[model samples]
Target: MKKIDERYIEVLDQFGFGLYTTTAGCNLYHDSSWGSYIVNFNGDDFVEMFIGYAETFDPNEYVSLHIKSHRVIKDIGEMLKSAKEIQILLLKVAIEFVKISKESMVKADV
Candidate 1:
């Protein structure tokens, strides 16, 4: 694992995402209810963001990008944009996931 830029933690921390280290990886950012992001680094220049679900370290999917300056790289710059990517990718995904999951349990009589 490469050293995680503090800016990543700085942004993610605002969203209840806590950084943890498991056998899976060192830069694991998890939210108890909103899924997880397993960050894989490449020689301090790039990263792969893996999104996990159901309280596990293993992610269901991923998106990769290169690290860039303030103006940003086209893809991941979104994550750094006032946390919008976190909201859309993690927070919003969690909300919709839970909603869809619970729909099956809804009482038909109600």
Candidate 2:
């Protein structure tokens, strides 16, 4: 498993998400109750961060966001060079994704 910043975990918690490492060694943050993933991290040197969404948060109806990477840092060496940058990128996307979700939900209710 790759080592991520503590703040990344904290951010996931604040958003009611859980982190899981896939069998293929990718990182995933998801909401189990909602049966949806918020993001996925794949690749080694040039990490690919996949941003996801769950607007209504329905286990059966939510459409997930899928991407190769929201932000890509290329040509990294063996030392996990872009951890901090990746963390910030992930956090920013997560925050915006959730904000959009909240706005959509509010509009839906009106």
Candidate 3:
């Protein structure tokens, strides 16, 4: 499996996401105020991106991004098709979600 690049890690860290690599070699990022993102790799490609919060926050909430490698090029408009594309796509969505989540929390506190 292709490892997540240091540049990507840097971006995530700046966004307040803590990175943790599992013993089995999966990548997981945790954001206390939002939730966790667990990347599931299938062979040389990413098969799924799971975004989930702790039960303490919201037990009923569970979100996932299913990445069909063969369909990614068509769906995401990526000229060069590959698993690396998943990383880029996932990062963009994750960052946006974090921004939205933080905004929602701020509104709730008002």
Candidate 4:
């Protein structure tokens, strides 16, 4: 495992998160009741990538990527796919809002 800055762990804890290291490895827990997401340190040369809450947590869903190797997730194809998914989701939400606004306008005109 790579060495990370102490401030990184402090920042994680300041936000109701917890960090623990066991014989298995270091794991990051977002909340008291949530399962831990294992921190992978494969190719972080400058700053190590410790596990942290993804800004949002869904108890029902599992992490999509397990390995933290920079080469794997940082590849062009994977990045493109991730970006495409975000774009699709954004488009869907935008379309929904547009539909709602159009209905509201029609009702006002009537």
Top of the candidates by lDDT: 2
lDDT of 2 by residue, 4-109 (tens): 5455566555655566667565445543322333445565421124344222123222121111333342322311323333345455656655565577679899
Ranking by lDDT: 2, 3, 1, 4
In candidate 1, residue 34 scores what lDDT? 26
Cα-based lDDT at residue 102, candidate 3: 74
Over 36-105, each residue of candidate 3 has an lDDT whose tens digit, in order, gives 3444333432212322311122221221133333323233322223224334545564565556557767
lDDT of 1 at 71: 34
The TM-score between candidate 1 and the true structure equals: 0.31
Could you tell me the lDDT of residue 52 within candidate 1?
A: 40
List TM-score per model, in order.
Answer: 0.31, 0.35, 0.33, 0.33
63: Cα error in model 2, Å? 3.4
lDDT of each residue in 1-110, candidate 4, tens digit only:
55544655555455544666655456644322222233333443312232112322222232234233433433444444443443343344334434554776798999
Local accuracy of candidate 1 as per-residue lDDT tens digits, 12-102: 5655556655445555354422234445423322223333432232221222222323333444434344233443656443444445435
TM-score of 2: 0.35
- Please report, as a residue range, the 10-residue window in candidate 3 with the lowest summed lDDT: 53-62
Q: What are the lDDT figures for the candidates, one per model?
A: 0.42, 0.44, 0.43, 0.41
Residue clash pairs of candidate 1 = none
- Please count the clashing residue pairs in each candidate, in the order shown: 0, 0, 0, 0
Ranking by TM-score, best first? 2, 3, 4, 1
